[model samples]
Target: MESSAAKYCCDNINNHGSSSQSQTSTCMQKFRLYETRSNFYMIGRDKSRTYWRVLKIDRLDPSELNIREDSTTYTESECSELLRRIHEGNISTGGLRFVTICYGIVGFIKFLGPYYMLLITKRRQIGSIRGHNVYAVSKTEMIPVPNATVNSSIADSKDENRYKKLLCTVDLTKDFFFSYSYHVMLSLQKNLCNNEPGQFLYETMFVWNEFLTRGIRGHLQNTLWTVALVYGFFKQATLSVSGRDFKLTLIARRSRHYAGTR
Candidate 1:
């Protein structure tokens, strides 16, 4: 894809004919440092860092560059404001104009392609909710009831009240389970994609998933007795850090317990 700067330049070149020279020069000045060697040692006054040694920069294709150094500078406030505007649902090009200008200016001094520059430029604007507001539900009005005023008619309707309460609790529990389960699945999928399968983090995730799934299933069934059962299983699974074998065993146990209950 053409870099955002390149696209911007193409669009503005005709409208600002005389101004294209400075803009193009600025674009050319940004050079991305494409380093091939991944391993490098940095020695500092108090600390040193080691990176894995890999390919040589000389072996890399001339067109491939990794790091870009741009001279564009913006105050944190300005960046925050741009992000705020974005968060407030203004996603149009005009809404992003300030951010684009900020990056384009910076790109002149830095060595980055327009694409990468745009990516970095918009990093601050991705997840901010600066101009958003949240309103909470208001409390319901309370009706005064005398402590001694128990009508026989209402008392006779206790079974209906109990049934209604049970139905509401069950619905609430189901809603909670669905929401929590979706998040758990998302988290597990993210971890699996980002990390090695046999790693400690991965194994722990398996254990967590097993424990959580059992608990959620138990809750869905309204098996009140299984609450402590799942909790204890999760506590044990998390506390034991021997390795994958132990974690697998815990997961198996949780699965078996869930199956038996069903």
Candidate 2:
């Protein structure tokens, strides 16, 4: 009997026209049919009626069911039109995509902001101390004794000593200058750090520092110190992942230290 009543309700719904009123009428008819068939079974009658009510509510046009608008003011056509507009992208463009891009850029800059300030502070501090050899005593202490004699047969070791001297004496200012690359790289790294993104920082820093101490010394020459500074900056930035490829090119231009040497 329950199956027959349910089938009867479904048939009426299908046969009726698609108008909202027709849908409502079909629902009412189904409810009445179920009640009559299950008159003796109160529980079954109650369950069927409740099910029919839910089906009726579900059949109603969703557009006409605005919670924000007053129930008394809602109309089927108006609700349908609203839903259509939303589907067609007639709403504002201020969505998560735009907001996310904006926030990501801002957050990236914010993360690198302090490092930039520190760079400026360092530059100014060095500038203020210019012409004063603060490490003069240390330099004097490390210098080889002028009168010390070594075995002439060990001439091969002289090349190694020369290389070390070059590494220590290369003037960094001649080859490099302060720029935004480091800041950007640091920012990128910080952004990655927040999300725990990559291992580039550790790996690249080790390689870059080794390159600076040895590989870059011969070509850097008078600008050796500048190259070291720039290389350090690049290493930091690359570690952060904010460093771009083009800036590395700019830094490479001053790498004359690698010129005549292998």
RMSD, one per candidate, in order? 24.9, 33.7
Instruction: Show model 2 residue runs off by greater than 4 Å.
Output: 1-157, 173-200, 205-207, 210-262
Candidate 2 has an lDDT of: 0.22
lDDT per residue (tens digit) for residues 1-262 in model 1: 2234433422322232122122212111111121112200100110011111111011112222222111222244543442343323323322222211111011111111111111111111111112221111111111111111222344326664564345335221111111101112124346346532211221232232233224222222221111111111211122346553332211112232343442
lDDT digits (tens) for residues 1-262 of candidate 2: 2233333433433243222322222211111100111111001012123322211111111112100101111234443342243223312321111100000000000111110000111221111111211100011012121111221333226664565456447443232333211222233346345432112321233222223233112221111111112332222122224563421221122233343322
State residue 164's C-alpha deviation in candidate 1, in Å.
Answer: 26
Candidate closest to the true structure, highest lDDT: 2
What TM-score does each of the candidates earn? 0.16, 0.20
Best by TM-score: 2
Model 2: number of clashes?
Answer: 14
lDDT of 1 at 17: 18
